[model samples]
Target chain A: MIRIFDIAAKDLMQILRDRKTFLFLLIMPIAFTFLFGFAFGGFSKGVSDPRLPVAIINQDGGDLSLRLVNLLENSEVITITQDAAKTLADYEKLLTKGNLAGILIIPTGYTDALLTGSLPPLSLEANITQTAGTTIQSEILAAANRLTSAVQTALIVGQTSSAFGPAFEQALSAWDNPPIRIESTSAVVQTGPKVSSQVAALAQTSPAMMLQFAIAGLLTCGAVIVNERKTRSLQRLLTTATRRSHILLGHYLAIFVLLFAQFLVLMTFGQLFLKVDYFRQPAATLLVAVASSLCIAALGLLIGVFAKNEEQAIAFSLIPMFLFSGLGGAWTPLEYTSATFQAIGHVTPVAWAMDGFKNITVRLLGFESVLVPCAALAGYAVLFFLLAAWRFRRVSE
Target chain B: MLQNAIEVKNLHKAFGDLKAVDGVSFEVAQGEIFSLLGPNGAGKTTTISMLSCLLRPDEGDALVMGHSIKDDQMGVKSVLGVVPQEIALYNDLSARENLTFWGKMYGLRGPALRSRVDEVLEIIGLTERAKDRVGKYSGGMKRRVNIGVALLHKPQVIYMDEPTVGIDPQSRRNILDSVVALKNQGMTVLYTTHYMEEAQELSDHIAIMDIGKVIAYGTNAELVKIVGQMDRITLTINAESGRVLEAWKKVQGVKQVTAQDGTLTVLADDSNQVLPRLFETSALNGVRITTVAIQEPNLEAVFLHLTGKALRD
Candidate 1:
């Protein structure tokens, strides 16, 4: 046990002495957390609001056509342009320069169709030059489709009900009433109790984010081990009373400590500045952090054992870590992705960590809720440590 | 019992089809510097590695301080120190920290560890630079710290494997002085080197190894005695030396002779007999001899006589 303590101490000392390790384990994570959370967070939330800039060229001089333009302008989605000289060709040139998303050309006979109930097929032209322009044009067409559906439904309702008849008869009473009265009622069902914006923000910046932050440090741990091996420092230790297990255990413990410290820093930041509810259930959060760190540390050891050198270790560790973080909802919520990808992500330890962290922060769960992920992480630690020990012994021998 | 600090009997180690150390055996007495001298790929490293308990011998009994390296490996390891060929000190750590960490590994702690670290730092003459990180150190300083780590535990037997491989001349001399100092303090050493001069300078007992076997093993004086009877004499004759060279070639036991630039260089197994005979031949030939010098044999000459190849080759 004293030997183990000595080994662990030496490992910690080496990590503390290394400036790169210190920076990665402590500083890099904090920087990434702020960089990713603010930059991408706003973009992700803004995607839900479908706002598009559209130029409408109305050649018709009728009240019905003018009313349609007012209806489009009144909706929160479309921002109508009022430049009359902007022809279709001019609009195309503006779109090429990224000045316009699309153009809406309302032909001369649009109001005649509405008033006489002899509607011609109205064309909604858009700039389909770029993919994004085409997508925006499709969105505008979809909005126009919604308006047409509403008009058709109102005309049928007015034909059947005498109360709204004259207004519709003045509009379109020749149309037959639909067999079914499709009474559309808009009901706002609450998904759950409304969480505070701060709590939701804290949930977004939970321990899983801390774990993702810790993974860069874990890669540094791999580089450290590989560097030691390449430089023959580990070989020198083998000549001492230190066994292969001691070296591996020492490094593993060192990385775990560094990662744990990083998690603590994130938690502290969350509690103080972000107002995260960690104190309400500290044990659960701590367990999640500890388990996640162990898993990542083991992953680092595995990479160190297999990689031929430090460069290979860094490159190899990045792929799995980035992939796992992406799949496990570190970059974005898994619910926003396809169900199949979410199921595939569940196989990764990051998925388990994210699940455990969400249970702790969002569900207000206890340690029992995170027992499985904790056990799985522990099992990974044991397996990786054993493999690293075996490899170290073989290589040294 | 001669009080052998390290004993190996018929050690056999093989890597697949290659016999790394083939049935070799030797012992180093307490407080002696024993050397394994060989060229590259000569199995000196494999032998020392096994005795150091870094590698397991396929067939052998290695007893370090009366502990079997095969069975009681932990005990063997506890009493042994190893200074590797490559400088193994951590670059990120200070010299003092490296020593302390190694000392702690040997179960030393508190004041004892601190004092030992201080003593080693002073011994290596790096006390002033002890606080500086090893990465900032020169090659010589790093080499000193590497030896300091091995000495931290004060083990009975220390193995130095090519410790002066790439250091400067001054640092190599310093390392040699440190080895001598350790031996004077009664520390047994197993030193391996390819340089014959280093072996002759430091080792009390030298085992000349080649191709996974010790071809010859003895004291420096004893090993040199193999070719001690045979010596070369070079004669500088002021008069026409070609005549003297012709006369010297005809003389019996004069294996070879060459005269160039008014000098005669002779190769003979018996210098005493050849010298007198050459004088007589020169007198009869009327060749005037200017200077005659006899060269004493060194380890290089001894190695050449034994293996028919130069030490460096």
Candidate 2:
């Protein structure tokens, strides 16, 4: 065991001497985290009541069409665009440029259709590519439905009163002020405190970027192994009383400990300075960090063992760092991707690590909720370690 | 009963159709300096590698301190210290750091490890600069630390493979002297080098190897005796006197004459008596002799006699 520690200590000492390693291990991860977070509006201090910008084009010029626009104007989730687009083509430009989420157009005969107990076909042009845009579309549909119900009730009241225009208008006014209402009866349930969308973005970006760069920093660990082989220290060690397991275990331990320390420092920075809830459940967060570090370190060892030179080691590490991090939702939230993409992303260990972290930071779940992700990470660690050990033995032979 | 520090019999290793080491065998007694002398690609490093448990021989085994290298590798490794042909020290680490790390691998701990590290620092003459990183040291200083790492455990047998290669003359001299000092202190050493001078100056037993075979093995004088009682005479002639080599071959009692770079070397019996004839032949051929020197038989001549090629060839 002392032999194992000796090898690890020597390697760590070598890595610490390199300034680039410090940059990768701690500096780059934090910088990227803050950069992504601020770019995505995660640093905003106020409550992030994200309102979707939409346009209402009232082609109908009637009281009923005007009433629909008024109702949409009062919605808290949708902000009506003042730019009255003249055509559907005009609305498409706004949607494409991301300046407008959707457009509601009321036809010219909308008021007459309501009086005759038939509905006019209102056209809705909306971009549903994002969740905010989808929510705006649903809110527009709900407001339109409410106006139709009020018009139908007024038509029925006008028929009973033996009056038409004035009686229907009075009925519409009365329907707007409802005589009956429903109230909530069930007990309130607090599923942990909810954070604003801005805070949530910070939570996602901080851990995702931290995990991504942490894996990248493992290239230094792999380079250490290659350097030792080039210097012939590995062959010299083989001639000592130390066994093959000692050298492998020593390198693996060094990579794991170094990455775990990096993760802790970054997570602490997120919690204290950036106001991210990484430490809401400290033990659970640590469990995820350890398991993730173990898996990534084992992967680094596998890269080191198989690579024949420093160039090969760097290439091996970089290829996987980009593939796994980019494909595994480390650059963006998995929820922002397609379902097919999210399923594919889960195949990478990074996704599971991100999931474990999100469970604590975003979901505000306790230790029990993080077990599945931690176990998956442990499984990956075991698999990577076994493969690395096999390759190491073959190389030694 | 006395036991040899290492014993091997008919060791063979092959790479594809090439036999890197073939049917080679030798022994090193306790407390003696044994040298394997050969040119590059002569399998000196391969033989040392097998004995140190870094490579397993295909057909045979070696016993290090009476432990089999094949069955008990750890046992052999515990008693063996190998200084590879390359400088294997970590340059980013201090001299003391490198020693301390290797000492632990050799199973030294606590005060034992500390004292051993200090002792190794002193032995390599780097005690004052032990704290400085090895990369900051001169090439010769790095070479000293490389050897120091091998000596930390005080193993029964130490393998030094061309430790002086690619270093300054002073550093090479320091390492050569240290090998002699180690032998004087009753430690067994198995040294390998292509430099015939190092072998002649330090080895108690010298094995001349070529093409993976031990062409000759014995003490320096004993090996020299194999070439018979012939003496060597060297003459430096003018560049235009190259044809003097053929003339000297015809001289009385001269067996062979070869010329290289305006110098003529003649092997003959009773060379002192042949000097007058040699001068007569040179004068006849209009070859102006600039210098003359005579030497008795040595390893170089033995290798030339056995392989019909110079040692460096």
Candidate 3:
């Protein structure tokens, strides 16, 4: 047992001495997180009027309803998306998932009420208890005021037109498409069942970059084993009082330390500088971090066990990094992608690690949400570790 | 009988059908140096590995400090320190750090490990540069650190497998002297080398192996007597060896003739009787003998006389 720690300490010393470890583990990941975060408008100041996402079900596909939809689309506060299949239940689900901030319903009487040149009753649904929901309420009031302005303008136009029908159509059309087309560029309004813009900024990219570079860092960590074999230190160690199991456990512990430390550093960068909400659920974050570290370390072990040299170890590490990161949604969230893609993405432990982390941050779930992902990651860790152990035994033989 | 520090039965190992260490047996007495001399692929390292418990034997077993290698590998490992042919120290770590780490692996801890590391640094004569990374050290310095790592635990039986291989003469002298110093401190040494001079100079008992089996085992004098007063006549010729080898083989009084590395060696019961015939044969074959030395029976001649080949072969 002491020998195990001795081995781990020695490996960590070697790994720390390597400047490349720092580059891969900290510098590269942080740089990519910032880059991807800015690219996706993931940072707080990177976006303006990051409107609360909401979906509209056009139960009334009338002219005024369409105008109202278009009017809400231009809302500086709330981004509106039309989804015929998005029921109130879907709205609730999205809200719980931290995707939709609210839901709007344009009922059948909306166009008729606009004909009378008055404020029509539009059902804006949101959980008032939540902060986002409260913010949405104020935005909804502002949109309602705009509607009243349009109605009064239509009332005055109705007198000259002699017909309420043409007047209402003209007023709503003018409201939606203004007289002077001031085509001011604005940030694209992301709506529907997706991660909230607040969460999407650093939440997605930080974890994605963390998981990706964690595997990338394996190139350095796994090379420790390859170097040992090449230098014959491993055989020398076997000639000591230490057992083979001690050696394996020691190496595994060291790899886990390297990967987990990387996670902590990258997460700290995301939390402190990027304003990612990893610490909102610190224990849950740690659960996934440890599990993911275990899986990645075991993967490094397997690579080390099979690779004949440092170059081979690097190839093994890189190939899996590309495969796992691409397949696991480290470069992109599995969400918003095709269902088949999401299914395939989960084949990699990175996807599950991302799932576990996003569940806490993007989805705003509690500790319970990360349990499945942690379990899956642990299962992968066990499988990879067992494979490494078996292969190590064969190589030793 | 003197108590032996290491005892071996018919230890054997095979990589498929290669029989890397086949039915080999030897014993090392306390405070003595036992050498396993063989050429490449002669299984010296394999035999050392089996004794060190780095590899399990396919048949039979060895005991180090009365612990069976098969039944108690950890016991054998605890008693043994192996310096492999390759420099096995972590190049990224300093000599002190490498020794400290191996010490810990050998179950040394706290002040004991630290002092042992410092002591080993002194012993290997690298105390001043102990803090420098092994990778930055010269090849000889790295080799010294490699040997230093094995001395951290002060095991009862130390296996130095070709420790002096591939080093400058000065460093090789330092290592050979350090090895003698270890034996003087009452440590048993199992040294392996292909260099017959090293074996002849160091071994109290020498085991010469070829193709996985020990062909001879005895003290230096005893093994040399197998050549029975034969003298080794080494001649460097101007002509190629392949041209004169067959003619020299038929010469009277020439026991065995082997040509290697631009030099020809002739074993004869009497150098006076064979020197003339060998010259006549070489002259007839249009070969000019450049240099000649007739030396007394040695391990090389024992190897040549017994195996009909050079020890280097």
Query: What are the interface RMSDs of all the models?
Result: 1.6, 0.9, 0.9
Residue B103 accuracy (lDDT) in model 1: 88
What are the per-residue Cα lDDT tens digits for candidate 3 across B133-173? 88999888988888888888888888999998889999999
Residues B120-165 of candidate 2: C-alpha lDDT, one tens digit per residue: 8999999999999988999899989999998999987899999999
iRMS value of model 1? 1.6
TM-scores for every predicted model: 0.71, 0.76, 0.80
- Superposed model 2: Cα runs more than 4 Å off: A45-196, A366-368, B233-252, B257-266, B270-295
User: What ranges in model 3 sit over 4 Å off?
Assistant: A44-198, B238-250, B260-262, B284-287
User: Which of the two candidates, 2 or 3, achieves a greater TM-score against the reference?
Assistant: 3
All candidates: CA RMSD (Å)? 13.8, 11.3, 11.9
Best by TM-score: 3
Each prediction's whole-model lDDT (CA): 0.72, 0.80, 0.81
For candidate 3, give the DockQ. Answer: 0.59
Which residue pairs clash within candidate 3?
A42-A201
Count of clashes in candidate 2: 0
* Predicted structure 1: lDDT: 0.72
Model 1, range A178-238, lDDT digits (tens) per residue? 2111111111111111222335444555554676656666666777778788877777777
On TM-score, the stronger of 1 and 2 is 2
